[model samples]
Target: MTEDARWLSGLEEQARARLAAPVFEYVAQGARDGQTASRAVDTWAAVEFHPHVLRDVTDVGLETELLGSPVGVPWGVAPSTLQRAIHPDGELAMARATAQAGGVMVVSSNAGTPFSLIGETGVRWWLQAYLPADRTLAVPMLDRAVAAGASAVVLTVDTPVVGTKYPVGRVVWDVVDPALLRVNFDKGTDERPGADKALDLGPHDVDWLAEHTGLPVVVKGVLRPDDAVRCVQAGARAVWVSNHGGRQLDRAVSTAAVLREVIAAVGEQAQVYVDGGVRSGLDVVAALSLGADAVFLGRLPLYALTDGEPGVARMHREVGAQVVETMRLSGCRTLADVAALHAPSAPNHP
Candidate 1:
């Protein structure tokens, strides 16, 4: 297929056909009513870019640093759970692709394979943590990630308790391969209580993590400006604004709307990242313009997983090309230029 055909929408279509019905819905659908998830994509349409003309638009640089780490693209993969359900190669395939593209891969705590294997790809990756109530269980994983060469720690704070996902709830686990969900957990008495119960983790936990790890701690899933500020104040190296891809709560505010407010709150103190409904490079430009340091993709990466590494690579290239072209047309030759394109009067939604 042409590069144009491999954009997120097309790949999503391909994935829907390739993945099992339950698997597809788990990856694609959001919580009850699904409005939050839908808004994540639809609201961006209301953000109109006022392109400047006659600028030196020949070379648009998409390279930028996130958390002081150099990345070729301005965006990266957001954490996804149980990826082996989507594809056999799972996170490992996606890691290889991210490494090839010089993009970041935020490997989920829920990844099917061990982090060590994924780390072997040498991709610039961040380990995403779903903190459990038990510090004993969570700390070793963080320490293991450090030993495995993880660049940063992404602590997912939104999911204090697992939100209701109807489709995923109906999944027939009997058919899924046991090896697919084999995360690096102790097989015997080492139980993973965080996987099921509410973590009850809070801002103090963020501070503790900062003190514990040499790796920068990125607090993901903050929507409110107050919470974002609190995370920064608690020593979060970065705050990732997300809605758990609309998986946690329905009727939640779209990431597109909350991002600007969150950035205004703690933009200077910490790097602010966002995810949810990010489908194209133009969307990435819009996010940067609105004040996000970088954007993340949740569904797109999982969808790309159906076709394995090549598919993921093509998605990156397509989005990167979109970023370049959008920059060229909008008179932005760099990320700073895109940031300057923010218009205070831009409509929040249709």
Candidate 2:
């Protein structure tokens, strides 16, 4: 195996060994038969690069901006719940690592760490939320996140209801102390009817979030080009192509498969980001080439968090270095160069 593959495999082994079986499976397994989850990474790998040769390769730049703020890299952490279940330090450790690495961390609404603590770590972060059936139930959380300095609000538009995983077995929530997952919400507020995830999330909810938070609304879990356009029309500042890391929908299309189409539809209207199955720096390049402004890492960072703060720091360093090396080898210096290399061409005349 390649060095990168070996390193990732080793990390996964360590995570599996350290975490309880249910916790590990909760992070590792996808819905149903795991077909979409398994295919997500392979789809990225299937994209072949036609590298340029004999160009300057001395310095490769990896800097970029997400939603107007500069980030040291074009990739960041995707929001995931129950991080404390993975390690004692949880999201706090992740915030420290991401801050040190100069990347963003999108905090889950169900985050174990308090938003204020995460903010104190100095990471450029965004808040990810699922609008409850009663939208007002989200107001306090949104107010809290903004007060804690969240730069954006990522609305996860999938999961009208949580998808069913096969085997119907006890998962991480069943085995862990439920308190670890309830730290973000007020006492018993989470169990209230207003706290249930909304079933009818539509484009207007995008405008509502933006108005309520006064923060850029990033519509996540979008896979269709038309849906992307609708989100932009409804005032979404960005549309994230994702499949909930293949956890919410068993056989949904991989983000890699539809990134270009989504970008094509709304590239001019808003920034485009993607997550799900992005495990390598090469995968980052492929997504950027297909017009994605940024790529987000989902399960990879969580697995690294198994080793705590330093493990996540190392993951950022390694992946960032890999991106630089790939860009240098491909005769590209900047993110724009990478995008230009894969720019769409005009049709030929007969």
Candidate 3:
């Protein structure tokens, strides 16, 4: 299927068939047995919606606020590494497409293009950061992003070291050329690490980042409710409930399993967001019904990147359309109605 088909499955098939084997595997698979990745997808697929038929559901809208930013839809693109590995246009293409769809694009700290260049596209964007061995190494990049008009700083806290990639049966490195990963940092030096390099960061690092940056800070890769509480207490503007898209740790609970608790713990204090194996609009509604302010999408966008900006735009519309349709069928006129009608069940978390 072509980009005009506007189907996610087609995008996935196209991306897999077109991308080089290593790049496809690196972007598509998870850590160790890939069970967590499989689980993330499976759990989302299990969400059951109770559609109310008596209400007049002529209009359905999916607009919402995320960390105070007005999002046209209830979902946005989660940060992913090595966009250049999937398409020649890379992060730039994704940013423009997201902007066209009136959604946010969280630019990865490991983006092939410099943050300023992506910012130059005038997209509504945030910078996804990795705390370095020396915090000083991160200062200039952050300052430059703010100067270039990034909306927020999403500080990822889960990866202290790279996790094993079971498909390759090793901690596979060099999946993306090291040269593309360095353009955003250590510009003139030979000392910068590759895109897959792990960060030595923890919750307290949120305090340090809050003190340092003028923009709002959202902590990503949090799965436990207690950790979610700590993130808000440490002054995070939002908590991104994720398991590194199940790429960082094997046997980790799916985000769907732990999201309700994390939202209950920190939703009132900070904006709660989630992303993992969220492939459909029904999945978006499931997350919203459980109290997520917004949901971020991962692999699907990379799959769309195989077809460039039009593909990305199509995916955005496709998902948004799904959300609107689901909302209509479920007898919810707005996101608030969706949340009010559904009471979430607490899931077991790791």
Sort every candidate by TM-score, greatest first: 2, 1, 3
Candidate ordering by lDDT (highest first): 2, 1, 3
Which stretches of model 1 miss by more than 4 angstroms?
Answer: 168-174, 189-199, 344-350
Model 2, residue 110: distance off in Å is 0.2
Give the per-residue lDDT of model 1 (tens digit) for 1-350.
23664456787888889987778887888888888987888877677877777899877788898988788888999988778887778898899998888889998876788889888998999988776666666667777788888988898888877677666455736457666773665563145454453357788887777677788899999999999889988889999999998888998999998888999999579999999898888788889888888889889888888988888888888888788888888898889888878664355696
Per-prediction TM-score: 0.93, 0.95, 0.91
RMSD of each: 3.8, 2.6, 4.8
lDDT of 3 by residue, 119-184 (tens): 889888998988777677787777778887888999988888877876654322555577667576
* Per-residue lDDT of candidate 2, residues 200-250 (tens digit): 899889989988889999999999999999999999999999999999888
Q: Candidate 3, which ten residues in sequence have the lowest lDDT sum? A: 189-198
Give the alpha-carbon lDDT of every model: 0.82, 0.88, 0.82
**Position 323, candidate 3: lDDT:** 80
Report the C-alpha displacement of residue 192, candidate 3, in angstroms.
Answer: 7.3
For lDDT, candidate 1 versus 2, the one ahead is 2
